[model samples]
Target: MRQDKNDHTNYSEVAQLRQQIESEYRAACEGLHGLAMRARHDFIQARMQRVEEYYQELSSIVGPEAAITTVIKINDAFAGTQRKQEPQP
Candidate 1:
């Protein structure tokens, strides 16, 4: 029934990071209303498929090809963060 002190702290940090990612994604998606429906659908499907890739795909909902690339960077950065957190062999 006991958790390590560092475990609780690490869990909190991970929760905060997730909140930041979602908030930033929402802010980025605000300019993407017209694309929302298709995005919502794609998001669901993507979630059903690969959860990790969801953020990048959601970021790209903005139809403009150029903007999509720029937006995807946000997701990419977070993705990289997760990758770096993994232990290397």
Candidate 2:
């Protein structure tokens, strides 16, 4: 099977990034951004469900919190992509 360019060759790198992000998230004590957090958590759950059905290998790589952050990033990236795809008026 052909590997995608985004596929992880080192799971450890993913784990390490997750750890770092979790540290930053925990250190955030501003007590704001709750709506964003909720949206991220919801997206993460949906993402994990799809991953379980599609990419079984990566299904276990993310926990709830990590998955949430990842989902947020994914959404942001997708939105940017969509914006780029639109024709400028």
Q: What lDDT score is found at residue 74 in candidate 2?
A: 49
Q: Write the per-residue lDDT of candidate 1 for residues 1-89, one digit (tens) a residue.
A: 35687667756654554455555555444323334434555554443344334434434443346334543566686556656756799
Q: Which stretches in model 1 have alpha-carbon errors above 4 Å?
A: 1-3, 34-89
TM-score for all models, in order of appearance = 0.36, 0.34
Candidate-wise lDDT, in order:
0.49, 0.47
Please give the lDDT score at residue 15 for candidate 2. 61
TM-score, cand. 2 vs. native: 0.34
